[model samples]
Target: MTGAASISRLVKKSFLGAYLEDALTLFEAGSFLAVIHQPDAYALAGTAGPAAHEDLLQRFADGVIPAPHTRELAVEGVVFGWLVLDTPSHAEASALDFVARSLREIISRELLRRGLGAETLEQYREVALLQRAVGKLNGSLDVYQVAHSLLDECMATSFPADHALVLFLDDASRTYRIVQSAGSRELPYAERIAQSRLFSEVLANACWDDADGEDTLASERMVKGEIVNDLTRDPRWDVDVPEVSRMLIVPLATSRIIHGALVMASGPSSRPFGSGHLKQTTTLATVTGIAMANAHHFHQVQRILMSLIQSIATAIDSRDTLTSGHSQRVARIAHSLARAVSQDRREFPDFAFTEMELQEIFYAGLLHDVGKIGVREEVLTKATRLHPRKLELIGMRLELWGAMHQREWTDLFERLQAINSAYDVSEEDEALLYRLANKSIAIGEATIEVLSADELSEFLTPRGNLNAEEWEEIKRHPAESHRILENIPFTSHFPRILQIIVQHHERLDGSGYPAGLEGDELLLQSRILAVADVYDSLRRDRHYKKALSQEMALAILEQEGRLNKLDARVVRVLTGALESVEHAEAPEPRAFGLGSPVDHP
Candidate 1:
């Protein structure tokens, strides 16, 4: 309700009406009560006995009859109207004075009650605003994003100003940079604000005084915040803008350390910031400081974790001389492919990876072969069908056979050597190996088979260097990789890292090893890693097979995609990315190996 209407209602409910009527009856005097409402007045209550007396009361209310015997009706020394009476005897005058005093006290009490109610309502509003700001500011762990949210909450809530800035302290440079801003004035990106002596003094006073000696006054001033009512006269107004008439500067700090400062300002025409603004700004700045500190600590931990992961991957790669730097290369390629896939709207319209998810993919790529650490060094670096020691033993057995049988086994030995090192053993070579395995040489002391059962099995293998047993051992690395990684805590930020690593060797058609997981069971990150692993393996020369050209390697990948052994969309994305690289004159593809090339004989 309007203020005047509320006051009128209060006056009617008070003793003004009853007291005036009692005075008229007691003294036979004409009396009335009227309330002043700006330029005019109106009678609230009066005597009821005579029409002529009532007519005189109305004329006095209208100012037609002179108010010569008027007593001012006021509360807190401010008059609202008058209590007027016709000439009365001495006894009636004293009674009327007491009634007037009682009426004034009632009006004063009512006004005080109304003010308290308004203040309570304002407190509730402030509480609600603070609750909302807390939620918004604490929602993110990114320091830069939290800074932006801090400024946004300040301008959008009860503490709105004509200008707002969130500045962060650069520890290395010992300077403040405007990280986020909102106002009519355009702020340059990362603009450095000079710290004047007054500005530094206020900041030092507002924050914790870290001196060794105890000073009660300094301790009291710590974290109380600052309010500059007149920027024109204050030396602490370091901002170049002169039009800002007032500012509230609060340090974004926690108990541990100070991160930066928050500055909120008003233009000359805007309302000056007071203690209320300082209280609200300090509350928001405190929440922002805690959030920024958490983000800073989180990023620090991430850097340390990444460094440890890289070292482990390097150790794994270094174990096998032939595949040195393989893990690092796969990580780069997988990260690149993931970026490509994220941008391929037509192929992956609903699949967009966040920065953390992309980091997970990169980490998975780097540590995909961690299980190789558990495998024997010889098996990891084996370049031929048989190990060197076993090959040497076989050659000695052949020489003993040739001497005992009185026949030259020179051509047969050379053919056996060819079969052992060949990328693919022909059917003719397999038959020769079978014949050799069945034969034996007899001597005076003992009888020894020319080729043992295990040797024949490894020599007759049709593809790559590893035989059936070694191939089984090689396949265990994926599950082994999972076993090693599951013990570590990777579920928080990189929840999919373990899954991606274990599934990198899996295929869409259930042809791949370890679990034979098919189709939709695989993650997109796993598919990306699979493509990168195979691509890098094909492009690098291994002990058994020569490196393939970029075109040939891609052709092999496309064939595998058609066979349902790899994700087609991921393959296409890699192809597009490589084409772009070629057009851009990227450096030559480096040599790195994962293992035996995928789908190669």
Candidate 2:
């Protein structure tokens, strides 16, 4: 049979029954039939039964065809066995030859049918396994989880690897770094390679590089549908374990770039892998490359999102010079506090935060005052007694008033000249100006007094320079922030982010703005953000007041906790944590450390 003939499409089991029927017709009065071959071998088709089977088998046992009564079964001039006959008159010699030939066709057809069935079953099984592996790979977006899982599942497929290792490309270094390894527990050298920084060196020696010239066809040979069956006899191969007689190395790559390489090795006891193993492993390598690419892309997108969050925080803080780093400080403080709470697992047993949840808390703290963007710039940056422009206008008006009065009162003129030249005014001039400072000063003085009254009202108001109307405008920020974020697409990835952003200003007591969500109604993230915002604000210099000392800030936080405006346990934990950190040298702010491009195995 040709190679194509080995792949028979005849799967119907009825073919076996038809084959037996055709075989029976080849005999006239055959009493027995005997077919013998290698002992204990499994065959697809065989027959042994009845008087026909017994007497024909006895004739063959006598070591001859028994010419007139028996015929030999031969194919291509080689004896397969014999089909013996026992007839009243021996069948014609020509008829016996035809029978033997016909029986050969039937047996061949049966063998072909069985071979195809087994092949089809194996194909189905492999397909099922591949589907399961692909499903597991697609289930997670985490880089390391997907990498480890893919390596494990690929090992279980068609070829059982004795030892396997997956290397991911470190793009910056232009070298493969082992990211995952398996089945190397008993192999010291392999384990050492997996754990060492020079893992690439050991694996590179076993695998051929693509740079080998096409003239040698080395690349073609490596990619051929068969395992690279030869091993280079390097001194590094002196590992004293079972020798890896066969190895398979396939590139994990798409059309774009070579992402990494997959290396699988089998020891002496394993049957040598062939074309079939190489083909299956090549497919697995392709799937793994796609998965790694996707994971890398996912992490890249997360980094971009984190940068966007920080940028937004920086923008909000930039609106006021005094608050340049306010948002960042709050975010850092909130992150520290959350971590402290998480560490105290005994008191807060259910406390937990996935990376994403922690990110949300930090973002909420950074954006707590995002609504200030909507507040009037005047209100947002309002500082001392008067806006600088209003103060300057008042000063100009006072000078003009003094100049106009200088002409009418000679003594006042002399006083003004003395004030301008010698920085002194006569006693009479000072007394006269004091007596008339409020009632006697004319239009310019009256106008200045009116402006001054407003300034005094603002400066003496205790905290912040906002009037009732301006304070109301400032209060609208939280709601304005909610309105602004509502139109954003944050809900698509994290639906809870918007609610956390809106509730950052909320207090445990019913005193906080937007909505007076009190007590248990508040989310833990929101409470953490609120506490962080208050603490950072207290220790940060603002237009309204000087910055409080760390001790004073902690005291105020404690007082707020006692008043039920903040969680007391959180306050205590955060304060203690801050105290411990204050004495140590703090690191300067830098970009978030997502992770290194290449992880150690």
Candidate 3:
């Protein structure tokens, strides 16, 4: 009765079934290998024999196989599988049946040897599937599916669990409840167990303090046991442990936050699971925990990016006093318009973005004017209608004229004092001198405007007025703004934003300067920014120009959009947002935030 025969084309099944069929066959050594259609699948399961059984049994008894490994049957969700060797009565057996049992022991031990080998392969396959699922868990929506599927696969194929249930720890309920379930009818009790002291203490409350796996699991059994804990502690639990008996619970956490716990269990058919069984189930629970943590981390990454963009916007305010906070206002208005467009059925019926995309857009809007940082303060905050050197030039001429008159005035003062003790220029005389000086300064400035730099230098050398050399300095601010933006960090990652900032002043009719890109050549963001920049500049408070009312600003934008320089859709979005903003700001008798407006469809 050799048991090494092979068969062709065998279908795979629960980890144990395939092993039993493979190890029970008998045949010629080499010929047996080819008998099975898929012999290779179970080729690793060893042949049956008494010696083989004894070897594995000794390995398990001495703890070489380990408690968790010894009870691996429970881990795979197999309700029960007794390792009946030819001879064994320690746990309890009849003395008269010992010899017959010994013969069976040899066969059973050989079966276990075969089964353990097959289990090793099956376990590795299960883990491989889990690793693959982990690699694919990049999106939030897929997380729930992958996690549930991982557990189900392990149960249905490995342990043949008719049902699988996952319970997430609900802090609010102070208990555990089924987040996902697909097994038995009594799964809802998982929620009821949330308030159980044993569950709260071992799995949720204090499992972390214990270092030993056995101690932690033993504590869980007290909470999860059907006869011992459930019968006495949970009167609500059905008298029979039909739905749940052996359970595996593992803590779920990452380096940053402890999200919750994962709970896996087998019903009444699978109670008193050994240590190895508990360990395997806990490992599966850990994988689910990591998937949840990854989703959390993705959101954190989004927050960090948003904060960096806001910091850049703040930098602009600190650098220029007159134009401080210009970028922030743009972000608000642009975001408002973006929301209007995003929510508008006419524009984007199904267009939706994660909060993170909107955050990214907001940062782009705020840093739109960061390039202005490179513009000189004199250029950015030009005090007068003209340039800085304009005023300085006047003072220089006035001083020189006073110097020339000093010598003659000194001689005249001495002579005048000799004739009269106290006589000075009369009010009329002083007024006449001041008038002549200002009149001469005006003539110099006007003439300086028409003169070339070289020609003006000749005039300044003679101590006459040329012109304020500052207006030219102020006009170059746009170029300075471009240079400043060229050096911005993360430009490659956000080039569209950089382009919009630099080309904001460009018009659609090729009337704008710099690159002279016209029409569709400009990005959508640039077109939107162009319209927004113009409107904001006209409506917002500025030192260089009077603030135009919203009505007037809208009129100007309407003309621009009509001419096709700026996008028409953007104009519509802006119009909607502006109205929304006004309504939001209008202290409607009882409102504190934007009013909810639902769509008919």
What TM-score, computed on C-alpha atoms, does each candidate reach? 0.46, 0.38, 0.33
lDDT of 3 by residue, 1-601 (tens): 1123222112223333444335323222221111111132223222233243434534433445322221111112321222222222122223213422332444455446445545543443344333334434433445467557655645553442444556555678655556666664555445654454544544434233347533333343322211121233454433333366554554554443344555555655654545544445554554555566666543333333333444556555544444556677666666556666667787557765444334434555675765454456655554333233643454455444446555233433233222221123445434433443343323544532222344223223221121235444433444555554443233233435456666666667776645677887776566665676677778865544467898899888888888876777778778877777433321111101112211111
lDDT per residue for candidate 1 within 306-353, as digits (tens), equals 335656676677655458678888887888788789999989998899
lDDT score, candidate 1, position 351:
86
Give the candidate number with the greatest lDDT: 1
Question: How accurate locally is residue 42 in candidate 1, as Cα lDDT from 0 to 100?
Answer: 57
Q: How would you order the candidates by TM-score, starting with the best?
A: 1, 2, 3
Candidate 2 residue-wise lDDT, 568-591, digit = tens = 878888877886533332222232
Span of ten consecutive residues with least summed lDDT in model 3: 585-594
Model 3 misplaced regions, further than 4 Å: 1-306, 343-357, 387-495, 562-565, 581-601
Cα displacement (Å) at residue 41, model 1: 99
User: Model 3: how far is 77 from its true place, Å?
Assistant: 79
User: Per-model C-alpha lDDT, please?
Assistant: 0.71, 0.58, 0.46
| Model 2, runs deviating above 4 Å | 1-307, 345-350, 389-460, 491-493, 580-601
Model 3 C-alpha lDDT versus the unseen true structure: 0.46
Lowest-sum lDDT 10-residue window in model 2: 1-10
